[model samples]
Target chain A: MPLPMTSNQVLDREFLEIRAKILDLAASFDRLDRADGSVVGDPRQSLVQEALSVLSSTQKDRAEQIQLLFSHHYEDDWQEKFNLPSAAKLRTRST
Target chain B: MYYFDPHIHMVSRTTDDYEMLAKMGCVGLSEPAFWAGFDRGSAESFRDYFRQLTEVEPKRAAQYGIQHYTWLCINAKEAENVSLSREVIAIIPDFLDCHNVLGIGEIGLNKNTKNEAIIFTEHLELAVRYNQQILIHTPHLEDKYQGTRMILDMLCDDSRIDRGRVLVDHVEEHTVRHVLDEGFWAGMTLYPTTKCTPQRACDIIEMYGSERLMANSAGDWGPSKPTAIPDLILEMRRRGHPESLIRKIVYENPLEFFRQSQGFTFKSPDADDASTINDRTASEPK
Candidate 1:
């Protein structure tokens, strides 16, 4: 899994791209803040805020942490929540 | 540059799509069984589908000088029917002897539903018993992260499963790292929408480096381009990546993973008789 480019080389190549993304994110947050209605009580918004915090953290596994933040927790009876049929009903007769 | 698309659904595509793929340097491709635009009624439907994958598609691909390999499974979206899923699983072994049959997959969770998990595990058991290589489809968009986690957990729980033989495909920036860290091959899918674009895929290649990583178009009956691997090659070249590195990701990596499957006997486009397709059966397709 050796990279073709050195760390400094990659950083030099992608620096602007990274900076632009951060700026874009900041602008998005600003836009959200400027909107009339608030999403303060929304779980998705909270997750987004938490993800931003994770990105700012000193930990090396920020991607993994953020992924888990948005993931569904394992549930044993998740099928009970959905009214999906246990057996498939024929949708179309193959021509 | 010659490349292999490790995952695509050619059953939903036309001969023109195959010609376009061959024209654009797709030397070979693998089509994992996928949802047929709708739920199929019986196990007989899957049997017919398997026949098409093993019999018809290869000849169709051969006409355009493209080698077609395939995986067999009842896709996750259809796996909600636990009874039908079991029926499909039972009949899968009947086609495993086919020359082009790669393994059991494109099988993974859709909504991370319990029924999907049950059927996913059942497919795993079938793969282990038969010693077939696996190709997985992690869920799309919003469900990807969670579904990928569940798929990984299921694979890890089975000690009989060989991590090296399994390919967890459709990985994005968020899930790619974990798939590679766990010693399984990762596939990034290129699409016009929903999955990674060529630019994003190239960025991933830079960040992750290419060991057990590869890319595919996943082009099916959707808003996708079958020529996407070439686009990835073009992107890599544009980013100043060496031809050798680009080839490793697009060509060598897929061959390496596929070599583990007993069914894969691919001849490179550079070979003397590369135009000649192997594994052609004298008996007509059933």
Candidate 2:
């Protein structure tokens, strides 16, 4: 049980601020990782998301950065988008 | 009048099954590659199973003029050994091209253990990779409840799976609502001793109304007869079930489910046979 006011306000405030930054980074990276991030319909991404969710925030942020860096080389989240319907143009070339 | 049995383990059954089912009006049957009532240790055992469902058994079925198709994979209870299960899974695609190999399953939780869950997810991945439908086996006896919960939980985890493309098999009264509520296909098995009988399966149909549902005989090394499904069809007719109602459970429902896997269409027999879903004699073998 967390005491009503036992934790330091400064530390709590700092945690919230860091968490916000982390989420923002995650959201943007999510977009870059998927050109169709609007639909996040790729189940493997859901697989990856579920896998990454188990990690701590620091690890998650690092993983997001890796995803962002790799995905920057392409126009879309090609890794997850390859077999899906939206990436039909890119899909034909790979085959 | 034709009937489709969604589940029959014909490997352990005999020539009598064919002669018996043919006379009873069983035009089409779907055999799920269930465990042969025991764990198969080697990749070779599963390979032979693949051959039987894909090659040997269908030939035997065709000779009887019964159209046979199969769901190919290791059974859930055996899938508890994740390593052996994966070995069985890897060999599946090789046999999938064989005649009547339709889907990668009878996959789900047997005892709902962690090992079973991992193997269940692997089966889901195979289904997505091949763009195939899945047939799930919800466990029996003591493990039934936990197995159903575990199967649904893993299924919900993967968005690649269309819940409608999965048939949760071996459903009894307690398990039907959970199977139906998830938007997946609900399957009832009619076995004389361990599982629900045909009479009970018909009772379930009466109570639930037969949409998104089907029934079968999971007859195997266990003392069950594959003709039980045809009996259920007859029981439905005896009680004044509409011809349309019997057709939905015995023919249309299973036909649609198997059709999701490419090239598994039912080419109805041109001959006069008792297997017609609406045939009054469909349940009695001459």
Clash pairs for candidate 2: B1-B276, B2-B276, B2-B277, B25-B274, B25-B275, B26-B275
Among the numbered candidates, top lDDT falls to 1
TM-score of each: 0.77, 0.70
How far residue A38's Cα lies from its native spot in candidate 1, in Å, is 36
Best-performing candidate as measured by DockQ? 1
lDDT over C-alpha atoms for residue B47 of model 1: 93
Pull out the clashing pairs in model 1.
none
| Candidate 1 CAPRI-style tier | incorrect
DockQ of each: 0.10, 0.01
- The digit string of per-residue lDDT tens for model 1 on B73-190 reads 9999999999999999999999999998889888998987878988998898799889999999999755888788778877776677889999999997678988999999999998
lDDT for each residue of candidate 2 in B56-108, tens digit (9 for 90 to 100): 77667766777788887877788878789888889888877666777877887
RMSD of 1: 13.0
Mark the regions of model 2 whose C-alpha exceeds 4 Å error after superposition: A1-95, B270-286
lDDT of 1 by residue, A1-95 (tens): 99999999999878645643543344345445544698879999788878887344544444334445545565433434544322211112211
